[model samples]
Target: MELTPPEFTDYDTRLGAYAVIVRDDHVLLALWDEPEVPILMWSLPGGGVELDETPAEGAVREVREETGYDVELTGLLGVETFVMAPEKRFARVGDRPQKNVQVVYEATVTGGELTHEVGGSTSEARWIPLAEVPALERIGLIRKFIG
Candidate 1:
């Protein structure tokens, strides 16, 4: 979530969808490597929901785009809402506190070869051992999946 001083009257809110794809003793994670953003971390393969798509559809599409794996969304895991001030780490177009709503879902890999996401926020998709997740440097959102 990104927040900044409210510069406009209209509320600034964004919707995002993510997937928790786990298999055997490993969990799927994407290496987020946004240009000009110094913060790099391993996170679930998902992104902002498109205007014409449902959250579930968005989750599936995002996972495929970021992880190069087709997925079937099984169930909604949870929804999280957060507001934060946007700074250099979370800059946006408007200087307003952004309300971010995240929808998390449980998904399973259906098909597709493992490949890096081209021209996207995430560069690599990997199935990391579950036991090693705790020690990895990642965004706080990771707790939602591992826990």
Candidate 2:
């Protein structure tokens, strides 16, 4: 039997906000354990920014949801973007290419304790040391911005 790869014909853009929160040389990250996708990744604590809310607000909300931390953004860490093929997406369906526009910022944890998310894209959250991050499996964004 002969087979061919599916042709990518659709395109979409997603706006996400992320925070780089460092404390005692460790970075706060979320474990993305979506069942549909086979790859497990550790990424910054953040997610899609809703239409009505600003990116900053989304960052705070996502951080709280994924990492159980209340954070205050300290400064902008510049914008980053990438085009992901269908098979590589974490949240979006695997049908077409997705352009991810990410707004990253520096933040500080103000309240809440370290806790894992229950029923979300991420299953666990942790504060991984900077020196140990390289050994763990991470998403592309982590390499670009963090380490």
Candidate 3:
């Protein structure tokens, strides 16, 4: 099969807000299914910040969508920045670097059930043991929160 680049514009950029939700020895994570890979990559449960929402609000919303858990922000963890070039695995267009500004927060689950996001970026939600996280295929953001 031949691989071609996806479409993008020079103005494309993204602002994301993610959360670290931990209880006991487990952390909440989402499974991201890559079309080009056989194994699913793991990431923290969160996504892009909406135009009308604050990063904190977006964190709460994303966590709920990805993990089926209503969470309350406990603290601001840190910000991680990524610049994706066109030749990167995720980028389809190389006109400009896609600067991803990621804001992470520490949160606690207040309500909701364990579920997966439907028609979303992630396919499954799981609470994985902290000791096993290092062996998992994950996005760079995972290191920012755990490390």
Candidate 4:
């Protein structure tokens, strides 16, 4: 038998991550402030998956940590991939080339009050109507999820 490398090969393709969150016509967004980049940008309630956690578990944990709201995963919404440049500054890392594979899920608010958790990336959390999402400065993937 002949040996060959996989047809598709890339660092991002090999080790991609996912995040799942919910949108109820209006989405709860976290306003982030970064010194190097634009301030007061909205983002979804989820984040990257940890090594020992499933995508769903990471989603729930991220949402709870960022927005202070517990959520129940209902179904998968979609998967999205994006190429992030290294030179570009991110909230977590000042500058890094990061490729993201986000697996979004439909979720429902299960428990907990809507309050910002301390020591989180987000400064504030608010439920913004989907109609108003376009006007707000947000990530492209988040907009897609809301849509």
Please list the C-alpha lDDT of all candidates, in the order they appear: 0.86, 0.91, 0.88, 0.71
Q: Pick the candidate with the highest lDDT.
A: 2
TM-score of every model versus the real structure: 0.88, 0.85, 0.85, 0.76
CA displacement after TM-score superposition, residue 141 of candidate 3 (Å): 1.5
Clash number for each model: 4, 0, 0, 2
Per-residue CA lDDT of model 4 for 1-147, tens digit only, reads 999887863324212222344456777787765456566788777766888888888888888887788888888878787776756525345444567778777778889988985766677888888789889988766768765
lDDT string, candidate 1, 26-137, tens digits = 9999999887667788988898999999999999999999988999999888999887665532557666677889999999999998999999899999999999999887
Q: Please, what are the lDDT tens digits per residue for candidate 2 over residues 56-113? A: 9999999999999999999999899889898787666758889889999999999999
- Least lDDT summed over 10 consecutive residues: which range in candidate 4? 9-18
The C-alpha stretches of model 3 lying farther than 4 A from their native spots are 1-11, 34-39, 89-94
Compare the candidates by TM-score and give the number of the best one: 1
The candidate 2 region of ten consecutive residues with least summed lDDT is: 87-96
Q: Mark the regions of model 2 whose C-alpha exceeds 4 Å error after superposition.
A: 1-10, 86-96
Q: Which ten residues in a row have the lowest lDDT in candidate 3?
A: 86-95
User: Candidate 4: where is the Cα deviation over 4 Å?
Assistant: 1-24, 89-96
